[model samples]
Target: MLWPFGTTWRPMRQKIRGTVDLRWLTARSWTTKWYPQGIDLGTWRGRRTLAVSWFRQDRMRRHVASRIAFVDLERSRHLDVALAIEGDDGELVPAQIHAGGLAWFGDRLFVAATGQGIWEFDLAALRRVRGPIARRLAGSRGRGWRAVALVAVRTRVHPVALRCSYLGRVFDDAGEPLRRVLIGEYRADENGRIGEFVVPGGPDDRFERVDLYTPGIANMQGAVRWGDHHLVSQSDEQRAGVLWSGHRDSLSRDRIPLPIGCEDLALDLEARLLWSLGEHPWRRVVRGIPFAQLGFDA
Candidate 1:
């Protein structure tokens, strides 16, 4: 079970005789104005716009410029337009998938699937071409593999895909049970060949289950590559939310002040703001918190 993680208008038209040539929507209706503040960048707008992509600053937009892709969980898909930062105006590209976590590696978009695996969407094609299922993920006790949240962390050691699992039982290659839930770090080199999997079992496997989930504890629902660390958004069913900041070693963790729970987090180093996605009736997909305050940037 992965957590974390939400429109439109028409214009008037005029018809000409015979063939009936039509002129659409008023200029005011087609016009887009970005509020200087983060006011209009939320679900409050309802159908205007919701979330922005975190890959805008990534160095992979050669042929196509970056786009803000919004992943709709219930709908089981995502939307990619030309640009949202400027305003939602461009071609609307829709892709099918149960998107959990999202990250951009080069030109491919990786979306974590709840307990399914990872989905790789091609930017050029603007659709889901493959969902390479890692049936036997590292540190599994035999429950296949579920990806709750995923991020491409650029660590001092290597650039790795850090993902969190939501499975209750872990499994190995041959489907042998090991433990319950595995926080894994899988790394591939710059060339993109398969690499190592390091499963950190919270110091002890026997107590991992109990230790990872306490009263105030939450499951990782959203993750982002913030600076040299992974900014993870954890949601507590009762409480507000918690955010963890770390790389290989646990640097620090903090509680989100708002009572609203945060799902997937997107940090724009260029914009210097961290956007946290809200749960259920999706909200706050655009409005952001200070990156410096969150300790995700310089």
Candidate 2:
């Protein structure tokens, strides 16, 4: 799929149909320390939900640890949950990775852990806790006011350990049984790569049938498919982003303007909205853009 050359590319403001703030800045001190990376929409415990992954920024502003924010759409309430892994002695320890992207499937939540591969967390294991008590007992410090933590039950390591900067699930009309997750790598000066990996059915099974492709666009933060076109987002840190719409195999495309700090992408067809989140602090928001506004036919 390619956007023909000479096609007029116009600049238009994207209309936001809905949005929810992270609510950590004014609520706690550790607010700005954590930056958003990925987002996904799904159901948990019979409730419609949205989840966003965040990484803790250290003194040098590098990502060191991560957590997830779960939003209950019905109640308009949100809960912060730290991602953890079990220690040698059955103790829970923080999962140290930049939880860059999130894809929720069934009762499992898949998190992109940069060079560490993908971490599969159990949604059913999500539990509430007091901040003060959890910090002492579970060594869960620096979480600010988060009331929940979810431990990783398994991690499927990618063969090449590609920089898993963002992720999105594949929607195939062929209806094949294989479930695939789309992995994205971010590059500053060069074009980024995207890969498709088949999700294993069981804990013992490994991710197979890995297929990689290049979208021929640099600085791509996230991507989602609509019909035959790929809606790719390219950003330069805090500057406004460009939304590229074109064929998956063609380098030519039309660029649409987006707000600054755009990170990951998720498409909700039922609601006809494209979900995206901001990365920088103070301006962070989980917002939805309608399909019509993205130049897609309704």
Highest TM-score: which candidate?
Answer: 2
TM-score of each: 0.39, 0.80
> What TM-score quantifies how close candidate 2 is to the native fold?
0.80
lDDT of 1 by residue, 13-107 (tens): 43323211122123221222110001112221132222333221113322121234343322322343322111156323222222344444333
Root-mean-square deviation of every model: 19.9, 9.9
Clashes of each: 13, 1
| Model 1 weakest 10-residue run by lDDT | 33-42
Name the top lDDT candidate. Answer: 2
Which residue ranges in model 2 land beyond 4 Å of their true spot?
1-30, 62-64, 127-133, 136-161, 174-178, 251-256
Q: Assess the local accuracy of residue 265 in candidate 1 as a C-alpha lDDT between 0 and 100.
A: 56
lDDT of 2 by residue, 29-94 (tens): 226666778888888567777788877766787755567767666555565566766657865556
lDDT, candidate 1, at 120: 38
Residue pairs with backbone atoms closer than 3 Å in model 2 (clashes): 1-247
lDDT of 2: 0.66
